[model samples]
Target: MIKNSDITVVVQGPVVASPDRAMDEGITEKCLTSVRHHLPGAHVILSTWQGQPVEGLDYDELLLNEDPGSNITEYTADGKPDASNNNRQIVSSREGLKRVKTPYAMKLRSDNYLVGDQFKFLQASFPERCEEDRFLSERVVVNNTFTRAYARSRRVALHMCDFFYFGRTEDVRALWGMSNLPDLAYDQTRNGQKQYWGAPHYKIDCTQKLLLVALQQYDASLNVEHLHDAPDDLIARSERIYANNFVIGEPELIGLGLCSKFGPQERANRLSGRLTYVNFDDWQVLYKTYCDAEFPLGMAPLRIRKRNFLRAFLLAAKLLEEALKRLKKKA
Candidate 1:
């Protein structure tokens, strides 16, 4: 049983992307309403750029930051920040943490809508033992898909999903506190390290990887876990499907329409009902359906002419060999 007193929900980011003020306010209002309804008496905090006005949202506290400098490290050659807007998250989250007084905190993006009884799942998954301090996230990114095949080949550990996170307030503070977007961007670019599969790994991906590393450095002893689990075979197949879609430049097929199926307006309505009605086991069934529908064919042509098919072929072989080794050990 998670109490509203135990948690404070932090919503942070830019307010409007376009000139349509009504559209921006509408989206923000829906997000706030969902948080208020689901969390009930939990305190809410909105953190954003200093002058960005957020009206009609019922929040307990509001924190603001001055306009961020244009010196973002994740800028492209043209000097524009990458689409991920990771620097914004770092700035807002840092500001929001200062006002967090609860024992637990849930960090959410202003644009992300919480669909289901995520809080219930959080309460059920909370680590009971003192030694097992851990954080909970909606999803986990492992190195299994084509986009992440290189890392998978190297067997890098799992990373937390950046959109939403739940943990002890102290732990949440530590995770977000370690985020130095500009420095991280400079370090990755300078070192020529590839932290993600596609595109130059952006700041969000880099920050997530660094957050996990920070846990080790600080001796936090906290493990990161996802809300749900699937069978190993299904997980592997889903990765292949996602990878196939990426290679073909079919963004529509990615995540099997789980996100696209529910647009922003529909999300508020669907999420609450789905969360209230469905159990984790049922959610897994729905996820598996999405994965199964996107099954990839073998030996597809590469979308980027410079990317070699032989390399991908060899990676498949390596993956198969590794799987065999694991199976033999089990046998």
Candidate 2:
């Protein structure tokens, strides 16, 4: 059993007030207060940009880092977004992880807060692992925000959620201890600033880049050149990666409380069943596939997205009707 005292909470990110936030308190204040309320004995570290307002913030220690300005390039090779705070995130989280003294540490966004301590109970859960891929003392706990399911429509490989992480201190450090994004990335000849390669199919987000770097530590030969590199082997490798190295849970189950900006309506539109994001149940399927020896293959079923399917079917029918009318007129 993990005690609250054994954990250090590192709330890293710029403090910015959201219009959706319910309380008038500053974002950092709400975050710190929640840490105090839910994990009373845990140490709290506030890691943010230098010169940010720090007065009245509750924290055992404060780390003010020089803002590594956002890396903004011309449009990507496939013409997608080019601006990302990848460097800023790396600098802030890496510095915070370096200061963690406890056996366990959680990396929470400064804009987010804890609502409960249930995630502590999950630290020791899911003990089974695929011996080959297991790296951490325990699987790092992360919310199911952008942990993509390759089998889903929103398929992408190595897209680990970076919003939060709760696990062994060193393990959490390893996850964030990655090189900052280079100013020049992807096919630079076309745009001279294409920071990422895949667009249309997959945009290499910060989390994806972060996890790819971390995975290379264990498997030096895992050469992923593009964002949409989801071959069957890569897909299976990703499944095992999540199975042995991380636990994906609902934000609530993980004691993570998103700001009001991510309320019910946003969640309903952005996140759905296991098809879009890897929920706890989806993680369980991967766990059984790689960890549980006796678990039969193909037994872990994925839920179908009924509503999306219906929408697609109706759109296809309408398109066919329009095409038929055009053909009759031409005849």
Candidate 3:
């Protein structure tokens, strides 16, 4: 399955436009030479102008001491942009994918850029890393976070714990089932003459709200076993995962795209379509079943069957892929 084309080496980062193409050429040569000792008969790189493999010379037959074509080796492409490496990164043949399992999991990039849970993960793990390089890091963080979370939550399942699902937080407080949200607004200006304001001054309101949502989601999905007193009941549900808001038994998954906003519109001037959820708890099922059936292995059946936070990540990836497919078609 590991085709020669699949095993591609990421040449380097973005091609910096310069008066001299020498920089790129030098880098390419260095990379090929460095990797050659490791990968025998490896394709070097391609011409700086046309990426096609340069032709008309057999290095073994006619030794120009260095043939122009020989100097630059051709790079195998995956027929898709290698989001992992800014440059196109070739995957070994599908058969070869089995070789790199743990530590280096293989992923195929879909058209869309979501990569779902992976996106949120990258944002947190590499808070300082460049935005462009977060794709793979996101997957690593989310995957690692979830694995640890699963281990810690096992004992709590025996004793039913009250989980404050952010999706249901407002509703819970309204019903008095749960107390006011953690950060309740204080009545600093309640003089009876002036109404008591619970809002965080309304100015810091948006920031507070964003922080709350981010924290809730981040804590729920990324907290894991980092702390002994981790917020075990943290529940940050993803719109993609909690998408069961639709009627079941429907044959076709009908969804609407968000229409573009004109002058009077609140959202940006673009039509955004709403996608219906086509899958269910199956997402958690996918991850749980993908490597091994670890879902039913937990001590608690209720928790074991629960989809947890993995659904969000998958949905993000799937949605991005779908979007990319549409763009490709248009192109």
- Candidate whose lDDT is highest: 2
Write down the lDDT of every candidate, Cα atoms only: 0.47, 0.76, 0.23
| Candidate 2, position 86, lDDT | 76
- The residue-by-residue lDDT of candidate 2 on 150-245, one tens digit each, is 422334677778889999998999988887777644454566434444444445556676788877887898755556677788878888888898
RMSD of each: 13.6, 5.3, 25.0
* Candidate 1 Cα lDDT to native: 0.47
Instruction: Encode model 1's per-residue lDDT on 266-312: one tens digit a residue.
Output: 64224222222212232223233443444333333232222334445
Q: What TM-score does prediction 3 earn?
A: 0.19
- Candidate that would win on TM-score: 2
Per-prediction TM-score to the true structure, in the order listed: 0.52, 0.82, 0.19
> Model 3 lDDT vs. the true structure?
0.23
Error of 3 at 241 (Å): 13
lDDT of 3 at 253: 16
